[model samples]
Each structure stands twice: as C-alpha cells, then as structure tokens.
Target: MAIIKVLKRENPYVQIDKTGIDDPNLSWEATGLLTYLVGRPNNWKINIAHLSSVKKNKETSTRKALLELRKYNYCHLFEIRKGGKYIEKFYLVFEVPTQYDEISSNMDVELKEGEKIFYVKVKKERNSNNLPEVENQLMVENIENKGVLPNVEKPKMVKPKVENQALINKELLNNNRMNKEKNHEYDFEEKDDDLRKIEKLFKEFGIDFSIKHKIKIKELLQKNSVDFLISHFKKQYEILKKKENVKSIAAVMSKHLFQGTCEVDSSFLLKKEQENQLQLQKEEKEMKQLNNALQVFLTLPMEKQEAIESEILKKRKEINPQIKKISTFLFHKMIVSDIEILLAKEKLI
Candidate 1:
C-alpha cells in the first residue's frame, strides 16, 4: 500500500476561521495542524514532530491546540514512532453531527462540497477580550450542554373498504354448480370411433394409457395406421347397422382392431451397435500403446533416469517428490535397474 497525500488549496487556519480571532498573539497553527491531520487518508499514522518545529516555548501551545482540537471532535490524538523517534500523531476524525447541538461555534464553517440547500442555527455572543480563552470556554460549554429534543410526527390512519361475505359466498357456490353441469355434458358426448380404435391398440400393446402415452400413440397412428383404421371401422359400422339392436353407430365402429408401427429402422439400430463395439476396441488399443511407451521410457540409463526424475519433481511442486517418483514407477510398470539397462544400450550415461 502507498501513502497518498492530498494538498488543500486554503491554509488550514484560514479554512477553520482561526485567523479572525481578536488576539494577535493567538496561534492558529494548532487549527491548521488539526485540519491537515484529519484530512489524511484513513489507516495512515504520522508523528507529532512532522507537524511543526519542536521548541520549548511553542511546545505547550502546540500540545494545547492539539488537545483542544480533539475535544471539539476535529482529530484523534495518538503516540507513534517515526524515523526512530517517539512523537504524537493526530488523525483528523470528522463525524456528521447527529444533533444540531453537536455543532461547534468556533470551528470553521463551510457547506460540505457535495451538500445542497441546507440550513442550521447557532447562538450569537459578543466577542470578548481574551478571544482564545473565550473560544476555548465556549467549546467546553457546548460539549457539556445536553442535546436538544428530536421532533416526531404521528402517522395518519386510513379506512379500509367493507365487503359483503354473504354475497361473495353465494357467487362462489353458483360458479361451482355451473362447472359441474359443464363436466356432466362433456362426459355424455359421443367419442370418435377412430380415436377409440387407437386407444384399444395401446391396450393391446400393454402400454400405459396415460395422457402422454395417448398423445404418443396418436402421433404414431397419424404416421402409420390412420387411413387403414378409419376404413376398417367404417366397414364394421356398416355391418353392425344391418343388425336390429344397434345402440350407437360410434360404439359399433369403436370395436375395430388397431396395430402400431415403429419410427426407427431395424437395420439402423444394428449399425449403431456395431459402431459402439468398434469404438471400445479402439480405446483398448490406445491403452496398450500407452503401456508400451511406458516400458520403453523405463529402460534408460541411470543418469538419464535422474534427469527425467528431476524434471518430474520440478513440475510437481505441489506434490511430494518421493510420492511422485513412486507413482511414475508404478504407472510405467518398470524398476530402477530397467532404467540403467536402457540408458547403457542408448549410451546416454
């Protein structure tokens, strides 16, 4: 992290209105120092000597100003060491006044840069001869004074609309009765003979007669047996009409037989199974090739083996080097002596 210093355009004393004090001897240096300290970025610590020169006569005044500024909530005072020396460091700590009473009269006044159209009230008093003492005393008095009472407003009440429970219940009952009558009418209506035949076909195939199953069966029927089944049912209906006890033409037609067809070609399924078996065989062959490569790698010189081991160790930083060596041996299915034999043959050592 880097320390960032922001320079304010106006003198700290002028910004805080300390220059306008009646006493010519009044030191506004403390006010300026406080302003600067408070304005620093949070989490930064500074030494007291960094503020001004250390002198016996000025030391008491400087210390007093720092303390006074803290009392007014302008800065946070603490001790710190800078450049191997112990010193006091002040941190600027400004908090928005929770109450109007918390505002200080002697402090510099300015609208916050981003604030708009805000007003506040302050008590006015005659300027006294001991301006610094008067200012200090006023600050003390303000801190001691109890805060003002907060203003509170009562919320307004609203009337709710009244509903007739009896009327609502009667309307709900009428809706239910009308729905029941509609359902009864639908149940008594005659079903199409061709649709009945499709249903019978699903039953013959031992398929679940659910809504989804029926939809699937209908789609299959449309693609396959729709025209044949309709013609067969019409013929059955004509034969039944010749008999005297025919209760319904639709019912008689509904007795006709149905048969379904498959979408997938049988030859296509056999071809797909054959391709899957070839893929499995190819995978097995690749495994055998990897095993052969490992065997060849193991039959190398000791020096060559060490070089490869070092490379593997370096690459496997997060893993234990010993565990990695054991894993490599097991993976390749070769011993250390095998490595030396291969290395000698290749003249690598």
Candidate 2:
C-alpha cells in the first residue's frame, strides 16, 4: 500500500457575495497568470505584456481585478526596463501557509476557499533512495557541458565466427586422410617384420616354398601380426585336443555313475516350471473375472445406472463437497433417478 500525506494552504481572504460575470468567451490567460505567479518565489516578478494573448475586454477586467487584489495586499506591482522601454510587472508576494511532514502520517487537511472546501493530498516520492542527488556539483557541471556525465568506456564484444557444414566436412576429411596415411605406414612396417619371420621359419623347418604356400602365408600375414598369428594357431590346436580329452572323460564318468548316486532332484526343476505356468493361468482367470464384472455393469439399464451414480454422488457430497462438484460437472446430463439406482446397485448409498 502507498502512503500519502495531506498538505494544506489556507486562503487568506473570504468572498462575501461571490457572483462572477459569466461569459463563454472568457479566456484562461488570467488563470495561467495566477498559477504562474503562485508558483514563483515571493520577490519574483513577471512582465504583464508577456501574458498570453486574450480578448481586450477580458484582459482589461482581469488586470483591474489583479490591481484590486494587489491593493488588498494579495500581490505587488512594479516597473522594470527591458530593451530601453519601461514595462509594468506583477509580483505575487503573499505567504501560503503549508504543513510538511512524512507521508506515513495519515492525517488529512482540508482547505477553505470561499464556500468550497478542497481536500489536499500528499504522496511520498517513490524510489526516493534511488533518486540522484541534486547537490552533486561535478555531475551537474558535466551534464550542463556535455548533456550527459562521462562514464567508463565499455569493451566491445567480438562475435564468434560460425563454421558452415562444408568447412566442417573438409576438416573432417583431411583428418581422416592423415589417419589413413599413418595406418598405411604402420601396416607396411608390421608386414615387413612378419615376412622376415615367415622366411626364417620356412628355412628352419626346411619347408617347401611352393607358390600356393607363399600365397597362403601372404593372406594370413595380411590379416594379423606374426606373434598374434602364432598364438592364435597354438590356442586352436589346444582347444581341439581338450575337446577329445573331455569326450573320453565323459564316457568313463557315464559308465560308472548311477542315478541313485546323485543328490539333485530333477523333478524340482519341472515343479518350478509347472508353478510358473499355473501363475500365468491364474492371471488369465482374474482378467476374465474382471471382464465379466465390467460387462455386467455395462449391461444394466441406463436409468438404473444413473440412479446409482446419483446416490454415489450424494454420499460423496457428504464425504467431500469438492468431489461432489467435480462429479456433478462430469454427469450433469444424467437423470437423477438413474443415478440413484446406480448408487443402490453398488451398495454405496
């Protein structure tokens, strides 16, 4: 809530008869003059010729009233020289009594003017703490000279260049070419070592280097390193030998072993499988039961169903008014009698 304070300035004189000459042609120049004079300091003066243009007759009447007001100590008249010519000036010097205080005080003041009472309202300036100080001479001088105070220069921001898809693709292609070249170099070095190892093995074993044998060795050398190929072949030979040994061992074990000697019950596995099948059957039966219940509920007469719903709604209203509101909105088109029957069938009444 905003806090406002009332300020009042009392009128020094009261009107007796208060009958004004009424003319639609009457101008607001007099009013403007009064407002301008009232806003100035006591000793401030303004030239009469400077008043905005008005009808001659109205201007004469306004000037006459102003003079009368001046005689009554409401204003002061003076003469000033401007451009070597003497001009008549008006100065309103009357003191206007006003009360000043914090806006938080909720006191209201009424000002009397003739037969009318006017209310004076005052409001605290918003964000007064954030307002610039009027007494900052250096800032004021800078603003007067440059129209704005000097401030620290801000660094200009640089925008990042966006790479197009074509440029990105070109960079990726160059990287892949370099990687392929490096891979080719590694492959040549590895193949040279494997070829030397093959030649040495052939010489040591006194194996015939026929064209078919050379082609087979070259094909194997292309796929793997020399050490890796030797280890893989050894592993394959061991696996074959182990498989034969395992078959012999199994044959002996089966001949000596009997069913009575084993403690594991094979029927337990069959029973577990049967239990799982029964669980699936039970789930299917429960689904069928639910489907039957839903069909039975759906087959009931519309009137009976509506009656049950109404009865359910009435019970729900007793339990929670919010639920009743929601249910009423959902089933607003249903008959009251049918809803009552629905509630009775469901034993919810």
Candidate 3:
C-alpha cells in the first residue's frame, strides 16, 4: 500500500483529489492542466488560448489535454445559446468525473427575460483561491455533499498567530477585487464603442430604427459579438436592398437580427472576395497579352501577315472541308485574331 503524507498550512491553498492526480486515464499534461484550472476562481473564463499562455504551455498540447479531459468527464463544455442560436461557449471543471445529465437536460430550454441559469451551474457552486468567505463555505459544503474523492480526509486548518500574514492576505484579496472592477469597467467602455459604431452603420444605410429597435439591437449585442452582428446586418441589408419588394430596411434587419439564417461567417466572405480578385487579375493579364499580340501582328509586313493567315486558313479547311458561310467582317476578324495567336505562340511578337 502507498502511504500518503498530509501537510497543513494557513496560507492560500487549492484542494485537489489524489485520485485525480493518480488517474491512469489522464496524461501528465492533462492532469497538470486540470489542477491549474481547478485552482482558479469559479467565474474565471478559460479557453485553449488562455491556457497556452501559461509558462511552458503549448497550444496543441493544451487543446489535446482539454479534449482528453472532456472525454473522461472531468471537464464539461456547454454552449450558451440564445433564441435557438449559439452565442458563446464555456467549460466547467470538476475534481472528479461528474454526471452531466442534469446540465445537459437544461441546455435546450429558451431563456426568459431577466433570467440567468448558466451562471448557477458555472460559478455559484465552486470556490478556489481568492473566493469570498460565504461562497467558499458554500462550495466546501457542496463538494462534501457530492462525496468527491471520498478517500482523502479533509485536513484540519490551523491559522498562524502572525498579524502580518493576515494583513498580507487581506491586501492581496482587495487588490484582486480592484482588478476585477477595472476589467468590468473596461468591458463596459468597449461595449459602448461597439454600440456607437452600430448606430453609425444604421445611419449610413438609411435605416430609420425607432428607440424600441435600438433597444432590441442592444440586447442582441449582449448575446452575439459586435463583429458578427455587424457582418450579419450588413449582408442582410445588402440582400434586402436588392429585393424589388422590400418596403422597410429597419423591419428586415429587426426580423433577421436573431435568426440563424442571417448569420454569415465573415471569413468565408473574405475568401470568396480574394478568389474573385485573383480571377479578375488573371483575366486582365490575359487580355493585356492578347492586345500585345494584336499590336505585333499589325507591325508585321503585309506579306508575312498574309502567310500566317493562309497557314491558319489551310488548317481550318483541312478540319472542315467546306467553310461555313460567315460575314466578311467576322471572317476577316477571325483571320487576324488567329494570326495574332499564331504569332504569340511562335514567340514572334
């Protein structure tokens, strides 16, 4: 039997189950990632990009680790959808394999006004370093009730009598709170800017939306990102403008604002535009070459031009013994163009 040694400390700590650390199904990278994520506050947002930013972390490894965790039921991925459309996604970390039937069953229900259900599952039931005392206790109780890692006994925590240590923890907690507030404020300013840009776009498009319409758009912004919404609305506006019977631009925009059919992937549009540009460039170059070839034919002596045309005409006669009746102008035009083609192919231009 392996003997486990327990240690106690008054400083901040994150509780992770030995069973999780010793899980044979998980690789070292995945286990380490789970430990780091479990140590963050419940409300902390996590993604592969953020995880890869940690020292000595690689994006490919982090992504694979997340997939591995998901496969083993240690991490749960949920899509935050509104009006039957996907808006965002988040993950929930658990120290032990968690039953996800309850969470999955609630995912399909449409959200009502002023209702918040996802946060309860994500943030309200967990605690980690820097959590408020009330929440921390609630999480402790919840974890105990769930019977996760039942083999590891809870260690008794004894606070040190040092005054400076208490003061330092207090100061660190306050600083964390301040930083969260600042980030919240910054997000508010950024959202305000997005709203202003959308308003300007509406004006440019001659869309006369009422205050009610503006409120509806603002609510949509909360669910979808500014860039996505802008792209969707712009494409919808263009489509509506081309319709012969479109009566109201504002009405059309409002109608399709939340509809999944109106959603256009901006990257797809950019790729299509690039392909069209390349085709146009190719055509222009070909036309330039054709014109240059024509100019070279004009500079050739009359006798030489006649000889080239005769050679082409002979080949045509052999292909079709009798030439089809064509207008004199068209026949001459064909002969000259063929001469140009022949000259260009022969490097005579």
Candidate 4:
C-alpha cells in the first residue's frame, strides 16, 4: 500500500492566519514548521528531524512552532507513557480536525528524486470512540473562572392556581362524602343502568368524570359488564400498591398514568426484587465474614485478643487516596470500627 506522486501546490488549502509566523518575536524556523504541520493531517508527525543537519535548523524549530501554537491556544500537547518512556503528541484544540493527509498506523512518508512525497499505508480498520482527549486544562479553567458550566438551568415547577384551591378543596370534601355512602372500591358495581352512577363512581376514585377516562370507562362498560371494570381497576390498584409506586392521587385518576393502563407489567417489580436479592446476599456475606473473624479472635488468649482489638481500633487506614479537605468516609469508618469492636467484645464476655 504505497503511492508516490510529485508534490505540487495544494489543491485545497487550509485557512489560517499566515501572518502569525511573520511576527517579529517569532523565530524563523517557526514559519517553516507551521507550514510543514499545516500541510499534513492532524495525526501527522514532524519529519524534519530526519533531514540533514546542514539543511535544517535542528528540531528546536519544530519545538518553537509547538510552543507558539500552545501560547495561542491552537493545540494541546499530550504525553502518553509507554514502556517506561514518554511519547508526546499534539491534538487540535478545536473539535473539528484539520486533515490534509489521512494517516494510518503503519503509514510512512518518503521523498522522491523531485519534490514528490510518497504515502505508504498498511491497510487497517479506522479506529473510533477511544480517541485522545481534545479538551485541555485551559478550556476547563476558562469555564470555571468565567462561571460558564456545560449545563446550568432551573427546572420548571408546576404551581396550583390560587382561585381554584378553595373550589378543589370543596369538591374533594364532597367526593369524600359521596365515597363514605358506599364502602366498596366501586359503588356502581350493580348499578350500571345510568351514566349518573358511573359519574359518581369516577368522582369517588378522585378522578374527573369529564375527561377521556370517563369515555374509556363508558366504552369498557358497554363492551363488558360493570363487574369486569371493577375487577380490572382493583387488580391495577393492587399491583401499584405492591410495588409501593403510587405516584399521586392525581396520577391514579388520569388516563395517561400507569394505574389507568390496567396492566400487570410485573417485570419492573421483578427487576427491583432481583436487585434487592443481590443487595441482601452481599449484606449476608459481610455479616458472615464479621462473625467468622469474631469467632477466630475469641479462640486466642484473652490478653492477645484484647491487644489485637486495641490495635484494630487504634490504627486507621491510610487517607492518602482522599483529595477532599475533610473525608466523611474516614469518619464513618472510625465510627463503624468502634461499634463493631464494642459488639464483638460484648459477645465474647
């Protein structure tokens, strides 16, 4: 996989501030290195180091160009450690990469008799997703100092209308009065002849009878019997109660809510049960270990056992890993150790 062609003017040129290299403070070698870097892809490596010393001003020219780029916030240098050695590379500061010459892992460059450049590629799949970090400390520090975080917004909250509050309270009290007349879950169990009974039944459940849920109940009642609707609603209510997921009295009344669906999707509850079982198993394992450790300690000589307990309670774990000014984890660990030692000592006595 090699192609050799005569190098000429770029068919498509990059748009950059060419006058940057002409600055009086910049070194002469910076202009050459900048041109060389802009010609290659973002994944390119500087090849001027391999040139003859007489023809080149040395690799310091390339270093100066890199320094200029860093000073202007154009790119960032990343050092990766490999085999006890460090390999340095530069990545573009901006997200959009500049790539004139696409690079591959085994690709190499060669100069021809003329000013032609050759590209050699050992074909391989394009690597994506696990790319190097493009963002640097400059981006983060700038945001921090300027108070510009990635996402900062307040959540919109629902507010009750003031005028409706008194009316809603009165309606709720009336509904409670109507519900008290009938002790059953649904009062319209045998009285489905009139829509008034159905409306009262809907109001008893704290649901609005004027909504689409009222229409839904009417349709279901027409299709099936009143007993069927009551049975289904009870089943749905039981499922919600079992999961301890009764969101609100309002949600139970709305057709869009889970309670209105009248379906026993136990998979959600099963997933929660599985999680609880795993947590219980972990807790049992920890208790078993603690009990075993206590039994072992009790078998030792009384003075040695007391010495071991004292040592265990006195020596704290190293807190080097903590970077916070005050570590709550270390404080909690100390409290837990004291409780555990006290309990074990009481059991032995």
Which candidate gets the maximum TM-score versus the true structure? 3
Error at 310, model 3, angstroms: 99
- lDDT for each residue of candidate 2 in 222-317, tens digit (9 for 90 to 100): 766788755543443344344534444323322222221222234567799899999999999866654454445456888855555556556533
Please rank every candidate by TM-score, starting with the best: 3, 1, 4, 2
Give the clash count for each candidate.
Answer: 6, 14, 0, 0
Q: Give TM-scores for every candidate, taking all chains together and pairing residue i with residue i.
A: 0.24, 0.17, 0.28, 0.21
- Give the range where candidate 4 is weakest over 10 consecutive residues by summed lDDT: 1-10
Q: What value does the lDDT take at residue 233 in candidate 1?
A: 41
State how far residue 291 of model 4 sits from its true place (Å): 0.4
| Highest-lDDT candidate | 3
Ten contiguous residues minimizing lDDT sum, candidate 2: 1-10
Model 4 regions lying over 4 Å from their true place: 1-261, 316-349
Global lDDT scores for all candidate models: 0.44, 0.42, 0.62, 0.47
Once fitted onto the true fold, the runs of candidate 2 whose alpha carbons sit more than 4 angstroms away are 1-266, 309-349
Cα lDDT for residue 298, candidate 3 = 69
- Candidate 2 lDDT score at position 88: 34
